[model samples]
Target chain A: MPEITYREAIRHALAEELERDENVVVIGEEVAEYDGAYKVTEGLWKRFGDKRIVDTPISEAAFIGMGVGASMLGLRPVMELMFWSFATVAWDQIINNAGFVRYMSGGLINCPIVIRGPANGGTGVGATHSHTPENMLANIPGLKVVCPATAYDAKGLLKTAIRDNDPVMFLESTLLYGNLGEVPTEEYLIPLGVADVKREGTDITLIAHGGAVLTALKAAELLAAEHDISAEVVDLRSIRPLDEETILKSVRKTHRAVLIEENKPFCGVGAQISSMLMQKAFDDLDAPVLRISAIDAPAIYSPHLEAKQLPRPTDVIAKVLSIC
Target chain B: MPLLMDTAVTTPNFDTAPINQSLTSEDKLRFLRDMMRIRRFEQGALQQYSQGKIGGFLHVYIGQESVAVGTVSLMGANDHVITAYRDHGHALAVGMNMNECMAELLGKATGCSKGKGGSMHFFAPDKNYWGGHGIVGGQTPLGLGLAYGIKYKGLTGAALCFMGDGATNQGAWYESLNLASLWDLPVVYIIENNQYSMGTSLDRSSAFRSCLAERAAGFAIDWDTCNGEDIYEVRAKTQIAIDRAHKQSRPTVLEIDTYRYYGHSVADAKHKVYRSEEEIERYKQNHDPIRLWKARLISEGVLAEGKYDEMDAAAKAEADESIKFAEASPWPSEASISEDVYFEVDRQTIAGRTGKHFFND
Candidate 1:
């Protein structure tokens, strides 16, 4: 086994997929000679050459739309947006073209593309740069949304996303890119729509995804250490497929649940999860499903204010304790 | 002043370019027949819209038939095409079956898009016709991407992106052009300057004083303009652009100054608020591509007298048969509502199981 950071996992996935599949190509701003803005695609440009690792201009709409069109023909294009907030410029291409091409073409065309980038508010990047859009992107019928919480999951899920025969929104976060986790030395794959129980306990269920999974794990540890309470942390790797069985099974054992995320509270991922728990396992709950998310406002630029804005382990602990 | 004038009245002679030397009588006849078929099919589409059989927006490509027919004729089978919503003519020109196109317009299951996409979104991947994009200027980058794929795959083909005059003003259009030029992607950005973007004319919409093709100069892409109403001119200019693209992996911006005889859509009738009926009549009588081509063919002895009447009758019959097929086609079933959403898995199954649990039941 080898321990790797989330950034290296992404690089490993891209390098592996590019080597394995002749049709796979990566296109984005700063992906080539610059080694990606976040360094997630470091050294790929030199290894794969210009054709496989394309360097695009600062035109998000053109490159994203090009990715969609390229995927339709034969090439599997992995388009990286510098920040997920920039996806707004190419909304029509993502929502109308990539999301509906196969359906509109009556299954005649499939847009096998992956649009990935950091999408969170951890770095105090302000409202324009930080946008956790897994909820919104997952709402699209034709799109599959994936957000990984660990290095092992990042490598596995990204590989699966590239191999998928449909458009996928691979949401990454700058906060988690440097975090290390143990992964197998040999090739491995973690299927999408599978939830992982980071820490299992019987008192309460802490539901989260992506970076929030760490917050939940820390909160669960605190609950066990400080209060003599046991808490189970569930990491939802895929937002669209939404492994309902694992979520229900966890909540059923714990009897109390608290949804956590770094996105805006209104219509966020937590809102959907709460609604699902209410409809699916209402009687099994000892208390109403609670939610802990970022404050319902645009992310502020000040580091202190931004820290207060996003959900933390303290917030998760408070929500869990209130429910329990 | 020319700025405020209806340029369709003073239609330039697009036949000035030396025609393809190898062009034969069969090629001329094929163009005539295809152009006539587009005309007849659109006329039938208008009829269906009026009769409440066809719904949503209907943009009839009645006057600009030569642009699509001529440009498509020059493209190889491997070449890709993408166009705006006024696209029935282009779809037919690119060899999409008339019945499937008509069925798509009628919202029937047998349509090229299986009724999921109506008039605004028709796609036939088999022919490399990417779509009937409804959003103005949305297909520009997609077309650019198709060219990128061609270059990436090392294919000896180009992607032709067709847009209306208004779409030239879109951010995506300019972005795509800049990237296409910078990358030397094999792409031809065709601007069908039909004089108007909906009710607004080019003078009112475009800030540029020069031709639309000059927009390509800003990106260092090669640029030219042609008489869109003339098939020979459009073919000659586009063939050169297409050839330069495949050989040099360069992009070209081509402006086809054509006209629309009718309103922008069924809702915007001709001469209602946009212009006068007399103005339209002037263009139709003088600048009709089909009429001009027929005359040239007849004078050149490629087409005999009375042959046009036979072609017209045949085109009308073919269009009527397509309409009948569309009328008899089935509607997409209820089970298909969530189908085709994802190629890797079933979207409907996920949707159906959203709140489904043993405890809930």
Candidate 2:
């Protein structure tokens, strides 16, 4: 095993897939020559040349729509939005064209396209730039939404996303890009819609994904060291085809659950998880399921305000303590 | 200070460009026959819509046949075609089977889009016809991307993107045109300026009422316009655009001044209030593309008077036969409810074992 950064893992997945499939090309603003805005696609241009790694103009609607069209033809296009919030400018192409093309064409067309970029808010990019919109994308019927918390999951899941024959929304984290985690030297793939139990316990399940997964893990460690309470950390890698069985199985054993996310509290991923648990594992719960999410406000630019806006480890710990 | 509206409207010079001299008698007949077929088929669709046989939006291409017939006829085998919702005429012009198109309108399995896409959305990938996009300017970028793919694959072909007069006002349209020019992608964006955008006329919707083609000058792209009532003028103008796209990988902005005889869609009543009966009757009688082309064919001795009448009858009969085929086709089965939501082969194995929320087995 080798410790690698999440950004490196994503680059590895993109480079390897681009090498494996001639049809797979990367298209985005600042993806090539500039080596990506966040440098997630660093050095790909030198290795793959200009055609495979395309640098597009600042036209989200045009490039995203082009991705849908190119995917419809034959090529597999990996479109990158500099930030997830920019997707609002291209909503028609994402939802109407990419999401409905296959269904509308009666399976005759498949958008083998991946719209990937950082979607989490932590670096003080403000309301417009900072958005954890996995919940919004997952709500679409024909799309697959994936948010990987670790370097290993990023490499494995992005590879699977490129190979999959449907539109995939690959949500990355601004905070997690620099974080390091252990990754195996051998090739591996983590299937979409499968939940990963990062740490096991019996007292309560602190469920999270993406940036909040790290928060839950830190909370679990604190809960064990300080309070001597065992907390299970469940990382929901993929949110759309949610692994309900894994979630319910963990809740059944723990008898208590606390869902955490960086998204706003209203109609967030936590809302869906709570409703599902209330319906499926009502009798198994020892207490009502609690949610630890960002405060119901736009992501402010002030560092202190941003800290308060997003879910912190202390918030997750408090939720777990309240539920347990 | 001079006002912008005071500028004289310089009518485009496509009518003066010499007609394609290589056209044979059969090509001339085809130009006439194709326009006639679309006009008759749309008339049939309008009658069906009135009788409650067709559902969803039925956008008839009654008056703007020359635009589709002219542009699509010049496309090569490898060239791609895409258009907005007023697409029945575009599909037929590209040689899509009439029965499947009719079946699609009737919501039957035998439809070109397998009954999934109604009147606003139709796709035939094998025929190089990308779709019949519903959203006004939704197809612009997609069409540009198709051209991008053609260049990416090293194909010596271009893509023709058809859109309504209203679609030019959308942000996507501007974004697509800018990129097409910046990248030198082989694409021709045709604005089928059919007078009205739903019920709002071009003058009301656009700031530049005199010429939509001049908007291309902002992007440094080549611009052209044609009188879409005459097939020869449309053919000559579109041929220049297509040649530039295919040979030089240059983008062109072509705005054809066409009109829709019927309302925007079959169910629309605003045309009655927004426009006058006299104006509609005038377009039908004087500037009808089919009638003008038929009269030209007879006068030029390419077709006789009796033979022209026979061709008109045959076009109507052909349209009627398609309706019969659509009436006989079966509705899609319930088992296929969620079949195409995702490509089943690439789906994760775990997805198959679970009870999905929005999709079926």
Candidate 3:
């Protein structure tokens, strides 16, 4: 076992997969010569050479559609987006071509491509550059969306995503890229649609995905230390093939749950979870399934205001306190 | 035969360009038959659409037959073909049977896409036919990717990507051109400049100098234009681009000037609003690819009088049989609604067995 940053974990996954499969190629802007926009793909390009680790012009739709076409021909492309916000320009390629090609082609072909990038809102990058589109990606029937919150999960999930025989939307948080955690030297895979119970408690349940999992954990810790309450923290690693089994299990024990995410309050990931819990575990819940998201507005440029716009531990704790 | 008769001796000064000098008389006759087959199949599809048997966008490639027939005639073992929505021409030219293509348009389970992809997305990877993409310029990048994969695998072939004149205006087209030229990908962008994009004429829609393919100059890509009515000229001009792709791993732009008899799609009824009766009559009398090829073959003694009538009759009979097959084919099962979304789930792999994949009531 070794402790590495979340960015390194992603890079490790890329290296391992690229070594294991000759068909795997990492393509994106600044991925090869510039190391990577976020440095997650650093050094792999030098090792794999230009063919395996390719760079592209800033035409998102063109290159991304090319990746879809390449994937159909059996080359597994791991396309990196500098920011998840930039993905909107290529939504037709991502959602229409990659997402629907399998179903539309009647399974005659498979688009085995992974589109990975940081999706977040806390960094004051403004509205256009800080979109958290996990819900948008997950809402589509054909795509699988992943948002890993730690180095261990990032390494495991990315490896699985590369191997999955469908289009997978691997959403990362730029804010969490350097966060460090222990990852095993041996290869392991965290299957998509499986939730991880980070902390066990009895009083209430706090559910979140991606970087919001850290906030949920922080809130859980504070609940125990200050409010004399124990809260369960559940991390929904994958959004689409949702692990309702784990979520309901945690909620059944705690009898209360609060969904939190950095995505906006309007029809976000939390909205889906809330609907799922209400439909399936309505009897077990002590109160209505509550959700706290980043304030329902454009990402403000002011750093202080942007920080306030993101979901925080205090907000999660306050939501839990009101219900419990 | 076209409903409007050739009452005027308005045929242009169409000359003979050798039809792939390597091709024998049998091969030249086969080209005529293939083009006639496309004409009949499109007629069947149009008839079906009028009867309300097919739904959503039926873009019949009636007049522009020689471009697909000629360019696809150049495909080698590793070469591929992909086109936009007006794709029945390319699909037939690539050797896909009338049965599966008709069944697909009919939305039946026995179709090529099993009724999942209607008219716009037919695929036959086994035959090296990548797809029948629907978007204007969407398939250009996909063509580049197909070429990229061929180059990556060290295979020798070109990907012939066909698009309409309208696709030339897309920003993605320029982006794809830039990438293909910068990377030296083996792709030939064949523009079927059918004189109009939907109802708007090419000159009105495209603001390019001389021709649409001329825009390739910005990317330092080689380009040329050919009169698409002559199959000989079509094959000869197309071969240059395909060779550039296969030998040099470089991209080229080829604009084939052709015409379409119908509107943009069967759904588009305003095709008559923009172009006049005489203009349409002129194309039908003078520039129709099938008519020109038929005339060229007749003069060359490759086709005798009444022989093309026999071939056209045979193609119509085959199209009729395909329509019967489509009408008799079963609709997809309700349980199949969730199938084919994931290859792993269909195969039931260990990884795919981990979670609930498809959801239904």
Candidate 4:
């Protein structure tokens, strides 16, 4: 058990997967000589050399579609996007080629490709650069979207995503990249479509994912120390194959729930979870499932306004207080 | 599969490539028969479409048969192919059974894509045929990846990625072409330039001089153009590009002069609005790949008298049988609609058993 940043955990997962399978190649822009766009793939090219680690021009569609194509031939491709917001440029390749080809081809093709990058809006990268697209990708049926909130989950989930025989849309956070957590020295893999309860409580359930999980955890701490309200934190590590049982189980016990996320409130991941809870756990709930999300608007470029634009511990606390 | 389907203007196409000389009369005749099969198969599909047997967009390769048949005939075991929605030509050329292809058009359980892909997406992995992709220029990058796989695995093979004249305008294709040259990938981008992309003519859509593939010059890739009607010309030019890919691991942009007799797809009933009746008739009566190839063989004294009739009858009969097979086939089960969405879910792997893949009914 060694402490490492989320960035290191991701690099270790990539290194392990590359070592495990020679067919796995790292493909992206600025990944080779430039370390990486965000230093996530730092030192990988130095270790793997030119053949294993490839750098493409600044064209997301070409490389993303190429990864989809290469994956069909049994070569597992792990493609990196500098920011998931740029995925819009390559929407046809990302959604149509990588996401739907498996179903379209009747399983004759399996896109064992991972398109991962930083996706969130707290850094004031503007609407062009900042996007929280977990729910957007999760809307597609064939894709497996994961937003690991911690170093441990990042390592375990990414390793599985590379090896998994389906197309995986791995969502990472620029804000959480440097956050420290304990990751094991031994090799470990986490299965997709599972949820983790980050902290145990009984009064209310604060449901969150990706960077918003940290906000939920902070809210849980404040609720316990200040308000004396015991709040449970459920981190949805995977978005598509949503772990409804884990989420419902926590809500069933707490009898109160609040959903939090950085994505816009309209048709957000929280929207889907709320609908699911109402249908499945209507009798067990004591309060309506409340949601705290980024204000429904484009990510503002102003740094001062962006802090308020994204989800915060205070927002999660207010939602919890209103519901519980 | 050059500038397009009707760029059939006579030009002295150089057949200097040694590869074309290796083709025996038997090989040339087989190519003729393959092209004829595609042509007749498209005719039969037209009949099905008229009768409401097939569903969705039906992009038949009626006139551009030689482009798919000629280029696919050049593939070795390691070589692969991927093309646009106008794909029945390549599907048959690569050895996909007519029953499966027709069933796919009918949306039956016995389809090549198991009734999922329909006309715009036909795939045969066992035959090294990746798919009949729908989106314009989307298959280009996938083609690069297949070439990437060849290079990564240290295999001496090339990926033949096919597109239309309109696909040349796509930003993805330029990006793919740039990477194809920069990476020295073994990929030959074959444009089955049928002049019109859907209802839009090449003049209105793509901006290029000489041919659509001439734009490949910007990427530093070698380029070639040839008549699609003559199997020998298509084979010779494509063979050189394939050789460049296999031997030097270099990419090539080959524009094959071909035509599509019907509209861009069966859905474009207003196809007559753009192109003239005389223009369409001239192509069918004179430059039709099947007719042109047949006349070339008869003049060469290689084809037996009435042998063309015999081959054409057999192709028509095979196509007719496909209709019967499609009619006899069943629709995919209601429960099976959820299947094949994920490999793990279909295979019932450990991960598949754990979660709710379909969240809503």
Ordered list by lDDT, greatest first: 4, 3, 1, 2
Tell me the TM-score of each prediction against the true structure: 0.96, 0.95, 0.97, 0.98
Query: Whole-model lDDT for model 1 versus the true structure?
Result: 0.87
Residue A160 of model 3, lDDT score? 95
Error of 1 at B105 (Å): 0.9
Which scores better on DockQ, 3 or 4? 4
The reply for model 4, stretches above 4 Å from the true place, is B1-10, B13-17
Q: Write the per-residue lDDT of candidate 4 for residues B1-361, one digit (tens) a residue.
A: 2334355465555444578777789988998899888888889999999999888899988888888888898899889999988889999999998999999999999999889999999999999999999998889999998998898899999999999988888899999998999999999999887888889987888777787878999999999887887777888889989999989999999998777889988889988999899989988997888887888788888897689899999999999999999999999998878888888888999888766778873
TM-score of 3: 0.97
Top candidate, metric lDDT: 4
Clashes by residue pair, model 1: none
Model 4: CAPRI class: high
Candidates in order: C-alpha RMSD to true structure: 2.7, 3.0, 3.0, 1.6
By the TM-score metric, which is better: model 3 or model 4?
4
Single out the weakest 10-residue window by summed lDDT for candidate 2 chain A. Answer: A315-324
Model number with the top DockQ: 4
Clashes within 3 Å, all models in order? 0, 0, 0, 8
Candidate 3's DockQ is 0.70
Instruction: Return the TM-scores of chain A for each candidate in numbered order.
Output: 0.99, 0.99, 0.99, 0.99
